[model samples]
Target: MPTLLRLHTDRPGHGSGLRLAASGEIDLSNVDDLKSALADAVAEIGSSGEELVVDLAEVEYVDSAAINVLSAYADAIHRIVVHPYLLSTLRVSGVTELVTVDPVQQ
Candidate 1:
């Protein structure tokens, strides 16, 4: 199996937003890790009023289990920017309404 998950966080300054960029595959095997990572990221933001941006530009695959975890965390997250490739998968799986998806750049 590929390494499949990379999480990077950045806090620019006081009241600045936190960016959680995820790369690689998110499947049943690593769905728990993804959930844990998101939980930790949410904790780090800690009601500071800073926005949380989750960038899924590098996620190549997402299984149903991953979607369920993401759906559970959607309300807690500020925004979810999923790559274009995953949008259809999410929609088909009925998870698009649970989270927001930023428009993919051309």
Candidate 2:
């Protein structure tokens, strides 16, 4: 069975910045969840100019669609926290060039 993607949005207090953390696999099957979450996060942080921190540490996998969605929001995103396993994928996909990609600290 495929693991359904889960998204958690939060703001780490005043002037900290907005964040969207995603867990589980992010393939085409559940890419919309990521898109919607990003859109909602962006809308919620409207006019504040706060950077969006995308935490994908728990994400097990991601397809091109998922990368596309992240790329689409590169300007709004401050950094992306991903597992070491996914770092190469992000690098190959050019996501690392578009935005900061950090490996989750063990």
Candidate 3:
């Protein structure tokens, strides 16, 4: 299988908040790309430090590197949108407080 990870940012309300929609697998192979994508978004946010939401609805698998990326950005993020299966991993990883999984959205 091809190792692919996709990340894009959505600025709702014309710059009020950033929604990072990530899909595919996030493992060591694409960790750097993931970080770069996030860094770009943060740079785009400018100095206002607006709220950000990470939408991971299409993500089916993740590795430690991905978790680390999330950890690094936890402070900048308002919440994380994830899938049910990934919830336990985030919880056990002790990041449940910043993550949210909506059944309807999933």
> Highest lDDT among the candidates is held by which one?
2
lDDT of 2 by residue, 1-106 (tens): 5459989998778988888999889988888888999999989888888888999999999999999999999988989999999999999999999999999999
Candidate 1 C-alpha lDDT tens digits along 1-106: 6446887788757776887878889888778888888899889878877787777877888888888987888877777778788888888877768777774565
- The clash numbers for all candidates, in the given order, read 0, 0, 0
The Cα RMSD in angstroms, rounded to one decimal, for candidate 1 relative to the true structure is 2.0
Ranked by TM-score, top first: 2, 1, 3
Every candidate's CA RMSD: 2.0, 1.3, 2.3
Q: Give candidate 3's error at residue 32 in angstroms.
A: 0.8
Q: Assess every candidate by TM-score.
A: 0.85, 0.93, 0.84
Task: Name the TM-score of candidate 3.
Answer: 0.84
Residue-level lDDT tens digits of model 3 in 10-101: 87687568888889999998888888887887777657878777788888898899898888877777788888888888888867665543
Worst ten-residue run, lDDT, model 2? 1-10
Off by over 4 Å in 2: 1-3
Minimum summed lDDT over a 10-residue window in model 3 is located at 97-106
